[model samples]
Target chain A: MLTFKVKRRIIYLGIFCFTLFLCFFYVIKTLNQSLLYFKTPSEIFDDQNLDLSKEIRLGGMVKKNSIKVNKREIQFIITDLKKEILVSYKGTVPNLFLEEKGVIAEGKLKDKKFFIANRVLAKHDENYKPPSENQLDKK
Target chain B: MMRNLFSLNKIYIFSEKTLTFIKSVFPVLLILGLTFALVLSPPDYLQGDVVRIMYVHVPSAWIALGTFSTLTVLSIINFIFKIKILEIVNLCIAPIGLLFTCLAIITGSIWAEPTWGTWWAWDARLTSMIVLMFFYVMIIYSQKHIKPKNRSLMFTSIISIIGAINIPIIKYSVEWWNTLHQPASIKITGETSIHSSMLMPLMLMLLILLLYSALIFLMKYKTEIIKVKRSGVKRL
Candidate 1:
């Protein structure tokens, strides 16, 4: 007959191994999904086979003077140093969303050159402040 | 052996001291941290008043991560050395750590809506933190189910060791992956990317939260000890 302690030890080991397996499986799945969810303008440009209909995130810096605010929609260009893709977003934009800053737009691409963003997110660097007020005025 | 590790009389004195500390120091620090965080801090040039959320959000995140790391180390020590006091310390910290983890997620979500334009995303950093919370829940649950003193400790220790692997993943997730969450501003290299103005309130809040967690853990630890003693048991 198996001792009580041995049986308990066996149960503990089983639970530990099971949980560890599940944790790793979940981690791997998340890592794979992240790669698919995140893409730069250049990556989308390079990947011709990427689905245009599905919603995706395109991250890049907003090009200077690319913003055009109209009555219904706001349009801009997202550039990843090497390539640029035009994006048009409707509804209110984030407060921090500005020109010459990093941004991520989530939407569907109409074609290789144009992206229709449903939601636009402004990305800022780690720096808390944008230099002094007068310094910005000097610029 | 457990009796020697946590004598009843010593626990009485320690709990009394902890209560006094909580009553005296905790309130002062809480008020100061809140004043600096909510009122004194300047609004962000870009985020404006929404930056106030960072005062709570950042500290909660730091404590959540810090508590988990502390729990993992204590678990390893308890497992290898078979120390009962270490196990009690480990158990006492889990609930507090879980609370901070939940706070971090809630605050982050609130901050995200206005800042990131989304309440939640399955990005690398956010998902990893959710996973860490799940791990904490599982560890807390297993403590109740596993029978036998040593067996429970072994299981909890193993679970914690496994979960510790996620801590590093959470820290580096923003850097390693392109996620909605931003990279860390305060690094250990003493080279902060944020301005001194914002960093001051943030640091004060962080220190206050750390102190608050210590106060909470001390109270919980004393309660655990009293409960164990009342039950006339040497091990929990």
Candidate 2:
């Protein structure tokens, strides 16, 4: 009876080990799938054969005076100091998307140096804005 | 045999002064913290009024993680030393931790809708936080439903040890993998990405929420002890 009880406990321990191993493996595999959410200009610049069919996000700072508002299309350059990629979007940009500020555009690569953006996100700094003119009157 | 692990009339009880201190101080702190977080603080330049959600959302995440860490430590000791008090502590902390985890997920969902253009994402940090919450639910369920008190406690302690590994994964998920969730603004290197004006109220809200959780834990602990004592006596 004692030997039988010991054998059962060992089996339980083995099962526990197998389950833990499988859970960790599953998490890591899923994590690898999510690795393409964003890429910097330097990363894309280093890659020789970039995927144009798959949509990707290009994140960097907007170069000063690089923003040009055309009738339907808006064009700007995103730079990471080492390299620059021009992003063109056909949609309205966020309010915080200012020149020389941080921004991330979601779209596909047009070429090695140009990106066609589906959406433009303006990354805001951490500071809070004080109440504006109309908001001050209520106080 | 395991059903009688805790006998009647031997549970720890808090002193009157301690109860009074928690009762009187926590409400004042809560009101002051809420007023500052909701009204006095300035809105974000980009996020505007929606940024106010951070006061509640961020602190809940912090407290949830903190509670889980405490549970992990207590469970480890319980596993090694088999201390009875530590088992009770583990049971008491689980529900409070679950409450905070739920609050963090719900408030985060609300905040994300305005800021991220979507209510949910498979972001690494978000997914791992949800996993932590599931662990909390598992702990609570096993404790409540598992038969034979000693076996249930042992199972819970082991489960907690297994779940402790996920806490670090949740903390560093943003850095390890590229995701939509932003990287942590506050760093242990003494540099904060946020300005002082916004930091002050946020810190206050976090402090009050911690105090509130502590108070709830103490009250729940007392009630759990009382329940055990009553049940044990009735079986006698």
The segments of candidate 2 whose C-alpha lies over 4 angstroms from its true place after superposition are A1-33, A122-139, B1-12, B15-17, B234-236
> Which predicted model would earn the best DockQ?
1
Worst 10 residues of 1 chain A by lDDT: A126-135
Residue range with the least summed lDDT across 10 consecutive positions in model 1 chain B: B76-85
Pairs that clash in candidate 2: none
Off by over 4 Å in 1: A1-33, A130-139, B1-12, B233-236
Q: Candidate 1 falls in which docking quality class?
A: acceptable
Estimate, for each residue in A63-86, the C-alpha lDDT of model 1 and write its tens digit.
Answer: 999999999999999998899999
- List model 1 lDDT by residue over B1-236, tens digit each: 75765676787687788778767887888888889888887777777778889888989998999888998888865554455778888888999889999999999999988877778887888988999999899888878778897787777887787888889889988887787788898888779867787888888898888878878887888888888777876454
Extract clashing residue pairs from model 1: none
